[model samples]
Target: MILEAAMLHVKEGMEGEFEAAFRKASHIISSMKGYIDHECHKCIEAEGKYLLLVKWETLEDHTVGFRQSQKYQEWKRLLHHFYDPFPTVEHFKKVAKG
Candidate 1:
């Protein structure tokens, strides 16, 4: 499995807006091929920040399949503006688990 992580820094006072946008955007991603699951968590220590964790079968499923799909365009349109500084996404493979 591939894990994608992003630390989203939403604009001040736009947490609700960001969540609403993410709700819509997530649907687009979830409908795509190779999508496993995802979770979004609001940061209690840092207001307006969120952590997005997504699981995929492979990195290509995200970097190529999902991002190149038409839904990604809509996802970007809906959610891109909410970020003050764009988040960096990272991919990881499970090293160990209990």
Candidate 2:
């Protein structure tokens, strides 16, 4: 499995709106090919910060399959505007698990 992580810094005063939008946007990603699951975490210390984690079967499942699909456009429209500086996404493979 491939783990995709992004640290999202939403625009100030838009946190609530962003969360509502994300709930709607979640469905778009969940329906994609190779999608395993995803989580959105709100930061305790930072008012407008969030952590997004998504699991996919392969790197291309996200980079190519999802990002290249029309669904991505909808995803972007629903959630992208909330960011201040756009989040950088990274992928990881599990090394050890408890």
Candidate 3:
């Protein structure tokens, strides 16, 4: 599996609405082809910061499959507005596991 990670920063005072919209957006991603699992965590020390980890069956599954699909438009609409400067997303393959 490949992992996609991003540090999300929700707009100030919109964390609640962002979370709600994210919950709705989550379904859109999970239904995509090659999607394995995902997690969204809020940072304790940072009010508007969050960590997003998503597992996909392969890199193309995300980079091409999902991103190219119309579902991505809905995903963008659901969550993109919350970001200020926008988050950087990176993909990684497993190297070592304990």
Q: Which one wins on lDDT?
A: 2
Query: Residue 5 deviation, candidate 3, in Å?
Result: 0.2
- Native-to-model Cα distance after best TM-score fit, residue 55 in candidate 3, in Å: 0.0
Candidate 2 residues lying further than 4 Å off, grouped into runs, are none
Question: Clashing residue pairs in candidate 2, if any?
Answer: none
lDDT of 2 by residue, 1-98 (tens): 99999999999999999999999999999999999999999999999999999999999999999999999999999999999899999999999999
lDDT of 1 by residue, 1-98 (tens): 99999999999998898898898788888988999999999999999999999999999999999989888899899999999799999999999999
Task: Provide the RMSD of all predictions against the true structure, rounded to 1 decimal.
Answer: 0.7, 0.4, 0.5
Ranked by TM-score, the better of candidates 2 and 3 is 2
The lDDT for every candidate, in the order shown, is 0.93, 0.99, 0.97
**Per-model TM values vs. the true structure:** 0.97, 0.99, 0.98
Model 3 alpha-carbon drift over 4 Å, by segment: none
How would the candidate models be sorted by TM-score, starting from the highest?
A: 2, 3, 1
- Model 3, span 1-98: residue lDDT tens: 99999999998999999999999999999999999999999999999999999999999999999999999999999999999879999999999999
Worst 10 residues of 1 by lDDT: 20-29
